[model samples]
Target: MEFPPLPLFTEVELKSEIARVATFKKVPKGETLIRQGQYLKVLPIVVSGAIRVFQTFEDREILLYYVRANETCIMSLTACLFNNESASYAITDAPTQVLYIPSDYITDWQTRYPSWNKFILAAYRNRYDELLHEFTDAVFKKMDERVLDYLRNYRDTHSVHTIPISHQALALELGTTRVVISRILKSFELEGLIGLHRGSITLKKPF
Candidate 1:
C-alpha cells in the first residue's frame, strides 16, 4: 500500500522523490530505532504504530514521551540538522513502520528544491510548536494536573486507564523525585482515585 501522505510531502512529491527514500518495518516491544548518544543520520516519520522517546539514567530508563502514527520523530533536530552528535534515544514501543529520508536529502532539497525546503520549514515549525506547548504546560500547570494530562495523552487504548509507566519513569518525566510520586500515587490509591501495580498504575474514574 502507498504510504499515507503527510504535509511534509504530497503524492507527487513523494513519487518524484521515491528514489531517495526507503521504508522499514519494526516489530513491537523494546526495539531501538535510534540509540542514545549516537549520531542521528536519518529523519524518520511514523507510517504506522508507535514509538517512545527516552533517556537512560544510572540503572533506570525514563520515558520522555511517545510518537504515534502520522507523527515525526526528530528529538535532536537542531543537532541532527547541523550534523552534530545525538544526545537522546528514539526507540519503538509498539510494532511500527517508518519512512526514512537520508540526512543529506535535506541539504540536497534545500539547494535544489524550494518546495521541499518550504516543507522542511513547516516540519520544523510543527516541532517547535509542540515543544512550546510542553514548555508552557510545564510552567503553568500543577503537578497532579500535568500527570493527568500525561496519562490522557499517552495511555494505552487497548487496556488500562493510566498510561503504562513506572513510578520512577513518571517522576523523571515530571521533573520530580520518585518519593514524591510515590506519595501522590499512594494518596490516589487511598482516595480510590487509582490503583497501583508492580509496573503500572490504573486510574479508577474520571480519568
Candidate 2:
C-alpha cells in the first residue's frame, strides 16, 4: 500500500521537494556519514542501502542501531533541536545513496513545508520511543536473554536464518562483555540451537 507523502502534500510535491532539497551523494561501504565527537553540520536521509550507528569510548566502539533506506541518518531533530552534540557515529554498511540536507534548509522547510515538518517530527518521536524501549530492555533483562532476543529480532528483519554480526559487535549491542557473549553463544551452540563460525552465527531453527 502507498503511504501519502507523509500527510499534507501530493506524491509529486513530496518528490519535488525532496529533489530540490540538496544534491544527492554516494558513500562507499565503511565510510562515515557522521562521526561521534564531531560537530554535526548536515543530516542525511538514506535513499538506498544501510547504515550502522555506533558510539565510541576510548578504543571501543559500541553498536547503537541500524538504519535502512527511507530512514534519516544524522539524528538532527535531537542534536540540533536540543543544541547538543551528537552521541553516535553513522557509517554505511554498503555503498549508499543519500540526500545531504543543510541545517538551515531543514529549519526553513519545517516552516514552509507541512508534510516535511510532520514527517521529521514523527521520525524524531519514533526514534525516541525506540530508545526508551531499548533502555527498558537493558534495565530488566539478563545479558544472555537480551542477546538471544537481539539475535532473533535481527534474524527476522534480515530474512536470513543466519546472522553475520561479529562477537564483539554483539557484545556492544547487548551491552555486555565479549566473554559473556562468547559463553552464551557457546552454550547455544552446544545445545544445537545455533551454529557458530568465524564472524557469523546461524540459527538452527526459527525462534
Candidate 3:
C-alpha cells in the first residue's frame, strides 16, 4: 500500500520529494521503536497502528504519550533538532508502519518546504495540547475518573470493550500503584462500573 499522504508535502512535492526522503519500516507488536537514551537519526511518523512512549523510573514506568496514525512524537523531533538522545522508550502496541525521515532533512526542509515549517510548529502545538490535557487530569480528575477515561478512550480507539491488561499495567499507565488501582477496580466492580477478570478489565456500561 502507498504510505499515508503527509501534509508536510504538497501532492506534487509528495510525489517527488517526500517519497524520496523517507524510508519505511514495518514492525510487529511489542517491537521497541526507540530505546531510552538511544541516538535519534530519524523522525518517526506513524502511518499505521500504535506506539506507546513511556518513561522509566528506578522501579516503575509511566506512559508519556501515544503516537498513532497521522501523528508524530514531538520528543523525537526535539532529539533530532537539539542533537540529544531519546529520553524515553517507544514500543509498538500493535503491528505498525512508520515512515522514517532522516534527521538532517528536518532543518533543511524547513527553509526549503513551507509545509515542513508548518508541521514543525504544529507538532509543538500538539505536544502542548496533550500536556495540558494530562495536567488537567492529574490535577482535577479523580483516579477512578481517569481510569474510566483511559478505558473509554482505549475502547473507542481499539474498538473493544474487553481490555487485556493487568492491574499493574493499569497502575503504570495511570502513574499509580497496583494496590491502589486494584482497590479502585474492586470498587468499580461493586458499583457495577466494570468487570474484572484475570488479565483483563471489562466495561459494564457505556463510558
Candidate 4:
C-alpha cells in the first residue's frame, strides 16, 4: 500500500521495504484494535486521531496512555519486539487513519533504517515520560483532586462540557472502584460542581 510522506524514511526504504509490508487502514471511533493477550502481528502508526491504551486487571481497568497521530504505542512495540502477546488493550478514541506494518519487518527495518530506529527510540522515550507523570499522580495526588483534573482535561480535549462516560468507566480510568467514583461524583453534585446523568456527567461549574 502507498503511504504518505513519512517523516523519517530513506528513498530506498520507501521503495524497497515499506511497499512490501505496510498497509493503510481507516479505523472508526470506539473500535478495539488490539486486545490484551492478542498475538502481535502488526504495528500500527497513527496518522490521525487518538487511540486509548489501557490495561485490564480482572474486573477493573486502568488507562496507561494514549497513542495520537505521529505516535506509536510502546506496549505494542514491546510486544512485537519481545515476540510476546499484547499486554494492554488499544481502542480508537475517535475515527482515525493508520499505517500498519507487519511485525516481521520490524527487526530488519530497524537494523537497516536508521530513521526507523530513531522513530522507535523517540516513541519509547515519550511514553516513558507519560508513565512517569502517571506514577506521580498515583503517588502524590488526592483522589478528588485527580478526578477533578481528569474531568477538566477530558472536557477541554473533547471540547464539550458534558462527558459521556459511565461512573464505571470513570472508575476504571481513574483506577478506583465504581462505588467510590459514585460517591465522589455525588459529592461533586452536592457541591454544585457537576451534575450526574444516567451514564454521563455534566459540568455545572468550574472546578
Candidate 5:
C-alpha cells in the first residue's frame, strides 16, 4: 500500500519537498526503530500502527508514550534537531508503517517553512502534555490504579475490549515485575473488572 500522506505542511513547495525526500518502510511488531544512546539520522512519522517509546534503566523499562497514526515522535525530533544521542528507544508495538524524513533538512525547514515550524512546535506541546500527565500519574496513582488506567487506555486506543498482551510485557511497560502485575490482574479478574487469559486480558466492565 502507498504510505499515507502527512497533513503537517500545507505549503505546496514544502509538501512537495517532503514527498521527494522522505522514505517509507513497513516494520513488524517488536522491531526497534530507534536505540538509546544512538544519534538520530532521521525523524520518523507514523503512518499506521503504533510505536512504543520507552526508557530502560538497570533492565527495567518504563513507557514514555506511544506514537500512533498521523503522529511523530517528539523525542526523535529533538535529538535530530540538536544532534544528540537518543535518551530512549522505540519499538513497533504492532505491524507499522513509518515515513522517515532525513535529519539534514529538519532545522532548515523550521526557519524556511512556516507550516513546518508550526507543526514542530505543536508536536512539542502535545508531547509535553503527555509527559506531564505521565509524571502526575506516577507520583499520585497506586499500582493497581495505574494498571487499570493502562488497560483502559489501551482498550480505548485500540477500540477493543480484549487486549492481547503478555503479563511480562505489560510489567515491562509499567516498570514493574511480572509477578506484581499478575497478582493485580488476578485481583481485577476476581473483582469482575477483567478476564485474564494465558496471554491476554479482556475488560469485562467499563471503569
Candidate 6:
C-alpha cells in the first residue's frame, strides 16, 4: 500500500503501524465522509483534495471549515478522543484521497508516538482559530461582505476565477436562503465585480 507524504508519519514504527492497519480510499466529490449523530470508527486524514465540514440545523447547513491536504478534522479527532457521536457531517469538496486510521489507534498512538501527539495538538489549535474566525465573521460581518470574502478566499485557495457552484449551494454554506445569495450575487454582477454564468460565478479581472 502507498502512503501519502505525511510529515507526522515519518517515524519508522508509526509508518509501519499505519501501513499495517490504516485504510486508504479515494472519495469522489460530494460523497459523505461522516454523518451527524454517528459514532466515528475511523479518523480521516486528507492526503489530497478537500473535505468540507458543516453542521445542519433544521433545513439549513452552516459551513464549519475545510480539511485540506495533509490535514485532519479536529472534530473527528475530538470524537475519537471522547468516543462520542459526531455533531457535524463531512463531505468531499473535491475528488479526495484520504487515509483512515481506526479510532482505537488514535489514543494509543498519542503517548506512543511523539509526532502523532504534536500533530493532534497542532490540528486542535488550527481548527480552534478557524472556528473563532467563523464565529467572529458570522457575528460582525454583513452577509454581502461574508459572501464576497467567501468567494475571494475560495478563489485564492482553489486558484480558479470561475467558481462552479449554484446559488443554493452557496447559500447553504453561508447559512442563508438562495434568494438572498442570488440577490447579492446579482448586485455584484451589476457592479462589475463578477460575471454570472450558467451554474457558475466568475470573478472579474480586478478581483
Task: Assess each prediction's global lDDT (C-alpha) against the native.
Answer: 0.71, 0.75, 0.87, 0.86, 0.89, 0.91
Q: In model 1, how large is the Cα lDDT of residue 33?
A: 78
Give me the candidate number with maximum lDDT. Answer: 6
Clash counts for the predictions, in order: 0, 0, 0, 0, 0, 0
lDDT of 1 by residue, 21-55 (tens): 75555557678778777787777767778777877
Candidate 4 residue runs with Cα over 4 Å from true position: 1-20, 204-207
Model 6 clash pairs are none
TM-score quality measure for candidate 3:
0.93
**Candidate 2 lDDT, 26-102, residue by residue in tens:** 78989977766666666777767788888888888777677777778545446755556888888887787777666
Look at candidate 3 and tell me the lDDT of residue 172: 93
Model 4, C-alpha of 50: deviation from truth (Å):
1.8
Model 5 lDDT on a 0 to 1 scale: 0.89
Off by over 4 Å in 2: 1-14, 77-85
Q: Which stretches of model 6 miss by more than 4 angstroms?
A: none
Q: What tens-digit string does per-residue lDDT give for candidate 4 at 1-207?
A: 446657656557554667666888888999999999998888999988889998877766778888988888889988988889999999999888888888888777777778788788999899888889888999999988889989998888777899989999898888888898899999999999998999889997556
Q: Which is the better candidate, 2 or 6, if ranked by lDDT?
A: 6
Reference-based TM-score of each model: 0.78, 0.83, 0.93, 0.84, 0.91, 0.93
Writing each residue's lDDT as its tens digit, candidate 6 over 65-184 gives 899988999888888889899988999999999999999998789889998888888898989898899899989999999999999999998889999989999998888899999999
For candidate 1, the TM-score is 0.78
Instruction: Please write out the lDDT profile of model 3 over residues 27-129, one tens digit for every residue.
Output: 9999998998998999998888999999888968979899988778887888998989889999999889998988988888788777777777887898799
How far does residue 206 in candidate 4 sit from its true spot (Å)?
Answer: 3.9
**How far off is model 5, as Cα RMSD?**
1.7
Least accurate stretch of 10 residues (summed lDDT) in model 4? 1-10
Question: What's every prediction's RMSD, in angstroms?
Answer: 3.2, 3.9, 1.7, 2.7, 1.7, 1.6
